[model samples]
Target chain A: MNYFDAQTWIGGWPFSFQPAHRAATLARALRGEGIGRALVSPLDAVFAPEPTPANRALLRSCRTLRNLLPVPVINPALANWREQLAVVARDRSVRAIRILPNYHNYALTSSEVEAFVSEIQGRSLRLVISMRLIDERHEYFAMRLTGVPTGQLDRFLERHPDMPVLASGLYRTDLLSLLPRHPNLLADLSFAEWFDIVDQLVRRLGARQLAFASHTPFLITAAALAKLGQVGIGATDLTSIAHRNLERFLKT
Target chain B: MKEDGRGRAEAAELIAEAARFGIEHLVALGDVLVYGRRPAAEQVREINDDTAWLVQTFPGKVSGFCYLNPVLGEREVWREVERCLGWGARGIKLEIANNARDRCMQPVMAAAQAHGLVVLQHAWSMTQIRQRSYHTDPEDAALLAGRHPEVRIVMAHLTGCGIRGILAAKPHPNLFVDTSGAAPEAGILERAVDELGPERILYGSDVPVRDFRVAIARVTGSSLDAETRRRILFENARRLLKLP
Candidate 1:
């Protein structure tokens, strides 16, 4: 079955949109290589504030591509984060709200996001925590983006175990370190690299807890899709990591 | 570079998945540990030990790359190579210890030639990082390839090596770039394919350090043609390592 991408992207004012606006371009590129839908995160969320404007623009651009799903980014650290949360709450079109604690310079331990999590839980909103955005080495020299600390993610999961959060941009070390303790956290298969990520991760966390993320515009869409496509996963496990478990994740 | 007693276990895990995905052959590159602000010979040994263990346990499936320190004396460096060979290591791996063009590399290359082993040097465009003293830019690796024409050299980290690395690698047939490091930059892989062609591009994950699915998938799922993809992903590797 042709799978939908969970961690797609939307961005670009002048050139940033090359990757962001290139979702259809990316979709076409993937189709050339055999990929279908991608649930995207807006570039403005990581690089700009009030991602709604750019996101709205991206949603408009992706009108021709039905496969590109928008998962808007909401910085809980923002002053009007509540307003942003309200916007996502009102707009049923977006399936998930992705958070970048590292890029936003806050810990998951922040009481502010904790309360925001409650509001999200109250509204039954799906939360996808992005542990990182770009490769730490390749990031802008001035930018000091770090992965969400292991202890911080562990505590966040501890405080709210029922929340089925999808943490994209997670490191292999962090995933292995955290998975044994935090069963509630469902990670996107995009950033979790290491050696044999699929088998290692599935054995530890079970394929059901795993979901696919393409991290389009930043990473090769085909590369991300291949993880969900290839690896050692059976057809059943592929169903779960690519869509079934994510479907269950959104349902929760 | 966070460690949680999972690195060793996870290494085996990635190898298994890679094998199933037709990545049957593995090149166990030692986690260079960032040279960690002047890693002593003993620390380097520890890294090599982990790599050697990977190759030894799997024997046929895995090939270990030995880590080196050029700043250290010639004796220590040669000793490490001997130790690695003794432990069944397949080749030598270098990080930002010194530029590949530096005079220190002469001894390292000489030892590699003596041991009848290939040397994989971590290379990237110094244009991005701009730290040339220790880091071996593509230019440095190219210079090394020029210096050691008889000895086989693998320039590690293709995306980090970027356009210039591919260009630097193009002139020398003895030199090859592994499709590892950085996010798969758009067109860089294609550029490498166009310049170096598939035969010169080797597939490496920089595993535990970089994502296998991403790195492997980058080469396998690139914009290049099927024959080129096969060459980069498996054929090239099988030939390079002489694996069956």
Candidate 2:
């Protein structure tokens, strides 16, 4: 069955510039391997001082990719967040706006996060908080960033309980640590690695709480797909993880 | 059943059924958090106690190991290790307490050497996870092995540890890696054999967390020759744990 890559990146990044030429090559390779749809962001979000350029670039390139659905990165903390929203909200092509708190240097507790949440909600857009971009140990030594704190996440969820967030860039332990604290938070398992995170998550948090995210180019798409393929879930559960559930939150 | 210690016991109750899928051994690596980051001597005892119970419960089908954190200092590390060995644990398992090369690890490798215990250190690609402190990157495990060549160190998580990890582990003959943690990478196991050779690899499912079926299949379905496959899947582990 086809799986929707719930988390991905496109366009050249200023920090870790992965040009669409490179991204498209990787996506073309993955499409060869059977990933029909991918929810994409910009690597520029991980590096650039501004999100608009990469956001615009991601928007511009996704039209060429039938399988890729653009998920614009919005820094509600930025003074010109309205312009970013106007860009995204003008078209139904982009489904959700992803926020990178650690990368953007804003706390979920901050006014920008609050305003951003309210605006996304006003436009009836979904929220996705990127908890991390890479494994912490391997993160740039000079650009030390930490995952979003559970306490702040809890508070954010408590305050905005109506919003269903797709928390990408989470490791398995972060998912475990937050599962009991926040029921509204749904995590995409692109980076959660451990002894057997799939089965453990299925037991602790149902498959409904998860979606497939290849994290592509940065990770081997087949290897990531194989990770979920190797999960001992039934065809039904696997169906939800691979495509069905993600299709619900994403723009077709 | 929840996949805690209690859940594993329930898993043991179904060992016969699991055997149809070729699960001949279930290595009881403990629920681990019995001793959190800095485990007390009592907490270590409890972890080993549970390990012992699982080993005895499954008999030939199960092997028990002791988990230690040397950052707690020598006394606590030695006490639980010695007690677990006394209680019939097969080896020692180390988690993210400290890197394998840390001065803190000296006493731990010493204890394993003294007790003739096979030490399983939690290892992953620090290439991606750069924290070298408590997290033992594969290079650090290689450093540990370069120092204590006589003691056996099985670096954990073959996939998370990745190619560079296998290469880091290749220099020291005493260092072995188990096919545990993460889903099986498509070709890393083949790369492991090419780098470390087949004998240095062992088959382990960080079970209840990873799929034993796929973990076993990584070896069982490898591109390696038949003897090497047999060596990786059964013989290597059987020799390591000294299973009858």
Cα lDDT, all candidates = 0.74, 0.74
Cα lDDT of candidate 1 equals 0.74
CAPRI quality of model 2: incorrect
- Work out the TM-score per prediction: 0.74, 0.71
Alpha carbon lDDT of residue A44, candidate 1? Answer: 68
The residue-by-residue lDDT of candidate 2 on B199-243, one tens digit each, is: 899887666565545566666645568999889878998988787
The per-prediction CA RMSD against the true structure, in angstroms, equals 5.5, 5.7
Interface RMSD of 1: 3.8
Query: Which digits, one per residue and each the tens of the lDDT, describe model 1 over residues B1-244?
Result: 1121346677677567666656677877676754573479998898888877777777788878788887786998999999988887767887777788888888899998887788898887666465898888888899899988888899988878767678888989999888888666545687787888778998877766566667767866566888888888889878876667
Task: Kindly list the per-residue Cα lDDT of model 2 for residues A4-102, writing each as its tens digit.
Answer: 888877644333212244456656866876888888888776667778888887787777777788888988778998888888777668778888888
CAPRI rating of model 1: acceptable
